[model samples]
Target: MADRPVPVKDLKLLDIKLGQLPGWLASRNYSPMGFVNGYRRGYNRFYSKYIDVKKGGIGGIAMLLTGYVLISYIWNYDHIKHERWRRYH
Candidate 1:
């Protein structure tokens, strides 16, 4: 018989959010939905992250989204400031 892993909930809490999915992405699987869908796949595969966000899982996803957003924002801010200073110099 084929072996199947048990449901993710039954797995330790640490396993679902920060384990196999990130490892898989680091090794491969560059698809956009990879992490978000992985969350659903681990949870119950019943909820959509998009709808969840729309209904207000904002707090949950916010930190993840904000890191990427603020990174680009700060990079752009610094780049523009550097260019202005260079033009003045």
Candidate 2:
């Protein structure tokens, strides 16, 4: 199961946008549907150009795992530092 390839349409990689709410709303002329569709169009374009079902899933999983480890390490370091500070102070 782990080696099974995912369908391209099901892989939602980097499909999110941030800080574009204001611009997207303005571009839509205050229409929610237009703004949402514009994002969908962009995401579709990105997926079509860069993402392949055969390759994307494995890469995405690897990236996610790497990111998780990195985040965990940083969070643990911060918590350890905080605990040491509290213990001594």
Candidate 3:
């Protein structure tokens, strides 16, 4: 449990709204099974929540990446400032 990044129960909650993909596609006159990807069905089922724009799927990933990058910048800034401070003093 200590080594696992996410629990099975938590992962199970990630199951969301994949059941509606086919109906949505059908309303638009598209076949759900017509997609070229062989694993599209499975992917659609698993990643439906992550693909929802309203759920912040891609945007959330980008914001998280940006936050970590800024944290890294802050961490490195002290070292650079220390070097400059030494040079000036």
Quantify all predictions' global Cα lDDT against the true fold: 0.61, 0.61, 0.57
Give residue 29's error in model 3 in angstroms.
52
Counted clashes in each candidate structure: 0, 0, 0
Report how far off residue 29 is in candidate 2 (Å). Answer: 3.7
lDDT per residue (tens digit) for residues 1-89 in model 2? 58896544344444425554444434443479867886898767656655646555555557557879999989799777887778542
| Error at 14, model 2, angstroms | 20
Model 2, global lDDT: 0.61
The sequence of per-residue lDDT tens digits that candidate 3 reaches over residues 44-83 is 6545545555546466567557879999989999887888
- Clashes by residue pair, model 2: none
Best by TM-score: 2
Cα lDDT of model 1 by residue, 1-89, tens digit: 98897655445445556655554345533577867766767555333443355466555466667878988988799777887777542
Give the deviation of candidate 2 from the true structure as CA RMSD: 13.4
